[model samples]
Target: MSVTVREVATPEPGRGEVRVRVHGSSVNKGDRLVMMGTPYVMRLALGLRAPKHFGLGQDVAGVVSAVGDGVTRWQVGEAVFGELTLGAAWAEEVVAQADQLARAPKNVPLAEAGSLPVAALTAWQAVVEEGRVEAGDRIVVNGGSGSVGSYVVQLAKARGAHVTAVVRAHHADRAQALGADAIVDAELEDFSATDARYDVCIDVAGSVPMSRGLRAVKQKGTYVVVGGPTDDPWLRPLLRPLGWMLRGAFSSRRVAVFVARPTPERFAELAAWVEAGRITPLFDSRCTLDELPQALAELESGRRRGKVLVEVHHRV
Candidate 1:
């Protein structure tokens, strides 16, 4: 798929919406999925022939430039960050529902904060909501050095759970720095083949077999699927999640395919965590708006270490 930056009319906020002057946005796996229109099943909602939305961004951080009627929670100049339910955050200005946004972290640059919403929220749901992680729980996070996995390691640690991060040898130190108690170098060993069992197994890499992940979990434990192989254009990514759902019916272990639902409350809590220093955004690299196509390619190349940020407005 080809992408190019084009000029368009600035949008106005409708009722209960606000227009933001976007400072930052980032490339996410979801953006790539949407751009590729993959898993084929997703195309049912995205579009049958082509994507309904041409813009390819979801995370946004910026200052509110205008507000619509009935919106009172935010003012014209409040710094905010949130997920756009639809794509289009790649542009200079975006109009979003006021309820979907939360105040941007004061300690971080808005560009960096833009990388947090989707990745952090996905981790939040996996560890807190789906996994129900608690103190003393043993958890293994596959792909722990990636965007979502990085946050998963930190959040699980904050909950006092013992975290084992599965990453490439090059990223082992990076994962360790994020508070992982142990590191499984994917280049050298298979974590699933070990005798150790975990209270929760969060699979963000999706490179390992589902059966392996299922076997790694303790009885009645949870296996949360955050990502999967995107090589097959048909249903490779969805297959593992669907298999997990089917396995969940009879298995003692709880299997869940994690899909992030971004809400104002969740965003607020994430912001609070950022402010409190419980979690921080991890950036792999950055590019300007004009270079987003290359950034997306880099993200798709599976070579990036963390979030690849797109500096739209570049505010401090």
Candidate 2:
């Protein structure tokens, strides 16, 4: 995928909208997929031949510089962080609906908060909403070393669940450090074939087949698909996760595949947790806005852990 930076007219917020001076942003898997315009299915919404949006970043944290008419929830100079579905967060300034953003906690760094919106929201949706991870439950998070997986592990632990993080051997210690009760080296153990059934099984990597996830879950347990499906594009836009949903519909197990909905309520909840020291967003590397392409390249390399951040405007 080809990416470049350009100077564009600063967007004017419409009614009930707010314009923010983006201080920090992060690259995500959605950004990579949208930029690649791959699997041909995503093109229907992203672009047929090329990307519709010029801006690439989606996770944004910044100060509200201006507010449009009908906006009463936020005022100029309020710090906020949220996801922009239309994608242009890499720029110096971005416009978003007032309802789409939540006030960033004063205790959290704006740059760190920028990395929390998308990944944390996705984890919240999957682990809490879909998985329904409760205290004393045995939960396994595949790809527990990944961006979303890290959140899932932590959130589950926060809820008092016994979390077993499945990751490469190299990330085992980090997973444990993130609050996982047990660390399973995926390279050394076949999680799918293991006889250890769980109360909930969260597939963050999408590396395993539906049957394996089903097998990993107990008879009445939940199996949640967090990330977009992996494999050929001809299957669907988000891919094989749809098939998992279909399979779960007929099974006795509570299987669910859902896309994360990033709203102010969820963002506020996460912000509160961050302020309380319950959830901490991790970053692999920090870069300037001009180095976004390089940051994304590093993301594609699969060597980095957690989120990669871009510091657009340094806080004074």
> What C-alpha lDDT do the candidate models reach, one value each?
0.89, 0.85
Model 2's alpha-carbon lDDT is 0.85
Worst 10 residues of 2 by lDDT: 230-239
**Among all windows of ten consecutive residues in candidate 1, which has the lowest summed lDDT?**
297-306
TM-score between model 2 and native = 0.95
Kindly list the per-residue Cα lDDT of model 1 for residues 72-190, writing each as its tens digit: 99999999999998879999999999999999999889888999988899999999999999999999999998888999999999999999999998898889999999998898989
